[model samples]
Target: MQVLRPQTSGNVDRVLDCHGNKVVLISRRRVFSLTAGCATFLAAPYLSLRQSRASDAIELPEVRGGGKIRIGLLWSLTGHLSVIEKPSRDVALYWIDEVNKSGGVGGYQIEPVIMDAKSDLKTYRSAIMTLMRDEHVLATFGGYLSVSRRAVMPLVTENRGVFYYPTCYEGRECWQHIVCTGPLPNQHSLDLIPYMVRNYGPSAYFVGSNYIWARESSRNAIEWLTQAGGQLLGEKYVPLGQDNFDVICKDIKNKRPDWIFSTVVSDSDIFFRKEYARQGLSSDRVPIASLTTSELEVKKLGVSYGEGHILSAPYFQSLGGATNAQFVDRFLGSRFGESGVTHFNMEETYLAFLYFKKSVERVLQENGHVPLTPENVRAFSGGLHLSNEESPEGEVHLDPDNLNSWLKPKIGRFNGLGQIELLWQSSEKVSPKPYLLYPERGVCLSDGLHLPNGTIVKAAS
Candidate 1:
């Protein structure tokens, strides 16, 4: 019943009252590049229907005695990461809304405890602590950067709470308490590096944000690059939110690598692409190939900034297929339409919720009325499969051993038409290898992880 004033931050627009919870509105500047008339025609009824459903749900009392199932949503909603992470959070909410509309999850209405980490590590820790101890959520989802993930890993593990990470990361470790739906290094670069080497030249340069994700992902890139007989011309890791890429641009110009592999994220990603283009580096000859860049960044930086550039991901907004077409249309018509496009991060978050919902349903069916504890949810989530219609990105499977999704890898190039054109994709889903280098540490056990030689390292309880 309390209407708070709008936040003046550049990352957020006005807040809406969804029942008692506040949902952040998207800014007008981020709308899709479609024609005004077409966009309005497509989006109007969708928005109206969504708003009406939200109202009906809010007005209605609890239909089932299952009550509310609380979960935590952590993201940097007002800092450097707001651009991508906000949409990611919105996608999670989107799936949550759909779940509630369809009779709730296992007869329980879901309630989310949303918090902003502000792109700060300390804030991530504090928020997870509150979600764990105070909110006591069944599971928490969100974390764009590796450092933020590391900041909250121990807390989630120690408390035995579930955490779902939705972005591609440097896959090095897998914990029993966390579920990673994003593609790992092997899932992405296993084919990407060889494809680049075959089509482009054999020399590459690396640029990324200074953190565990960039450092570890670059390490995997180098491993694959070396295996492909490619040379590493140079490498650099800048701090997050660092906009100026002049020095790095100069180095790239001098080194003249055949391709540039970028791991920079958020606002920094937009700045890097703009600076690289401003330096007169043509994507045709010395294109920038990235694991982190997506349609969201390209939309913000302008379609021209991404023309001819290569990107590897599990999903892209421009992907063809009836399911993907419907997915994109729904996104373009939703309250979060300001995002303009659906990318890997948002899609993976949607997949995570799907996984959660299916797992909870299975658990309920088997147990016949039991508490949806973190352990029960985690136990059933592994080795789950989702059909093509259910998942926008074809069919996907979650590996039982590693708790990471067996994702279909894809390579795409941004064209002048403001969309990424698919170039290559795995014939089938690729199993995730979190520890790409050390296979022994890849498998997960109840007590602990496996050793290099398949020996189980039991956890001390």
Candidate 2:
């Protein structure tokens, strides 16, 4: 055997022979091979003597294969929900990068397959089908709007795939395949009305885009408002794609309620805000408390128009906590820059990935080296438990019926400085109740009674 010499001149730290083997010279006398395999084999019994200590340091669930785990991310990259979905897309990308950097999940690198839903129901359906059947993704995550999740829920269930829907919505439906990582209306809307009424008095205006979510959410708001001795000034419904808010603004101005309880979704929020600003109505004069306005929307709406707007949701960029701060720092630094982080779909997306990670780890621990297929993921996530600072809503437990987790809701306000400040929190953790009693009650009452058009209903009168 030929003696290997250091490649570098003078004092050398390492040596590489002609055969491309490596060795390290720590001092004038001490020398060792750079190959861990060689080291392990030479010191087998000695290594076995210290196996317990080494095992603790190298503790990880045994994964069957060493490869890349392909994850399909279906999000609204463009179109009506782009503003909300973009953050989620960014977060998913960030998670993929981070996981790869940290040696990946379960010793497998994550390969992300991204597709844009473009906010269209048909497009969402097609994207999920493609990711499931064509791409054969191990799992899928990211949905911002309730409509999109609703459209794909059946497909995901039928395919036995995993979907993490990150949006506050009506909680009447649940599926075993899809995991709702957002708050239900009761967690967000029910108690919020009481809080608003106690602080802002008992008169409110209801405005929303014409959709299943908005309609149902508004109905629940009406019930809570009525129950709290609050009077309904008036209610208006506008079509989803309608841009002109002139009529709605006029209605709001005429009603002049104490506060505007809005359930507007998508681009309607921008239109409503601009219109409200144009009407010379500041948030202080007639504050608009909403269920959907997140930090992402505030950034898009700009400081002038988004200032002082109140929102009730689980996550915010300014939430105080070590975990939240770290998450914000990492997420913003990687995707949106240090100062550009916003509260949007990203928080939910991040939580979804973490939930998936936990579920996968659980599967590995229990089943040992199972394939990370969609069915395996669904089975794993069925019993997944996720708790994090980003989830201000508290610990989210998977619901047995739908396999979705219930997120807590918090109240935040846009401070006109491109930041959202947390204001209030749910007094208690709200459990996931599948049936929306408040909205159902409102629907039943409205259908049963024949109230004349343009009639103002008073709860306390």
Candidate 3:
């Protein structure tokens, strides 16, 4: 509710675009955006990541090696993924710009060999191969969908190449090659389902895109809900980018579940919510809860459509703290300009690079050159700790066991003003077991519990 209203800060120039919903104010060196919720202003003193030198534009290295650090940037910039996955790509570039501008990590300029997956499975595999075999990047970063992450992960492990994947994905499959920056089922779904059962209602419905991330997460959501004294009314999955949600929306209306949990992606995510609103449904009656939804999705869907929708993640733009305030402002100003918005997708990716920077610098300091191998990165992960104080998120504890970080969990609601209102957050970061080492289910069954398709594992005694 507390908004920093703009006073006579300086001589300001107002810019109006075709998108009339939001007004952007551009000043000499600062910019502020008037959004549907809170009016956001430039945080000021944003450190320039990339230099303006003519040489910085070239992505491929001049000589390939020559004592320079190279990072592989992979994300879907075009085709089906252009809407949801591009931010992951941009943030990777943002970090590369930051590292290179600061004279690089340990005296070597970092160069990004950027590749677009085009939202295709085969492209994801092929891109990683080129980054490792041809370009010989020190490490690779990017992967939005769990299916694509699953597809490309094996290739990275086969080559023993390090990958910094940033996406809130399904829990299971602890891969040796990936350092996951995204939250898992326990961090978001299990935590979210329990909260809803106690506070919102005990009956819920599940909807998702027809993919591994949505389907598997839905299974865990079912387990968590059942254990929490809640009942699952229904579960369904639609094809990716299936926009016509009339049939599903009609089905849900008839079902009359207390709340809805959605793992839908891309176009389906945006369209379903719009149709949800068009069906005369409001969050007060039945709010849509999601681990995949972010600020960007909300912005695109318009504030009115997602007014009371709930989102649970490690970070949010409205997360009040000195660190969060500083990062959010600089990121919005530098990356997207005054009119730009911040989302969890880019925030996690941004934080991942910052965490990886520490390891890269450590490797360079210990050995004269940055070793381009997964083993070298894994060796330094134990020594590396990304303090919650440094990031917009409270803290990130890097768990070397599964190569996934123990992230502090937070839940928020898109309130009346179209801004995220903090509902709940853990005081400390919780340890994660991606392969279901310690589940919320009381007894860790040696035989392992199985749902429709997914299995929940017990901890090792």
Best by lDDT: 1
Per-residue alpha-carbon lDDT of model 1 for 1-461, expressed as tens digits? 12366664554344544544444432222222111222242233223223222222221111123667777889878777789898988787776766777788888877766777776655776677667665567888999877667667666665667899988887767577788889989988778887899899999999998766788888888888999999999999887788999999999999889999899888999888888888888898699889878888888888899899999999988877898888778766866566878888998998899898888888888887766687788889888998898888889988887688998999999999768899999897898877668664546555467676766653211
Relative to the true structure, candidate 2 has a C-alpha RMSD (angstroms) of 18.4
- The TM-score, computed over Cα atoms with residue i paired to residue i, of candidate 2 is 0.78
Please give, for residues 1-461, the per-residue lDDT of candidate 3 as tens digits.
01133333344222322322112122121121111101111121111111112332323222222467767778776766678777776666556655666777667666666676776665666667667766667788888877667656656655667788887887666455677887888888878999998888999989998767787898888889989999988888887768888988888899999999999888679899989989988899998998977777887778887688899998888888888787777766664333256678888888778877787667666875534355576567653577657877776867755667788888999965556888998877887656563444323122233333465542111
Alpha-carbon error at 87 in model 3, in Å?
1.2
Worst 10 residues of 2 by lDDT: 441-450
Listed per candidate, the RMSD to the true structure in angstroms reads 11.0, 18.4, 13.2
The clash count for each model shown is 0, 2, 3
TM-scores of the candidates in the order shown: 0.85, 0.78, 0.79
Q: Which ten residues in a row have the lowest lDDT in candidate 3?
A: 33-42
Highest TM-score, which number? 1
Point out the worst 10-residue segment of candidate 1 by lDDT: 54-63
Candidate 2 residue pairs in backbone clash = 175-402, 393-408
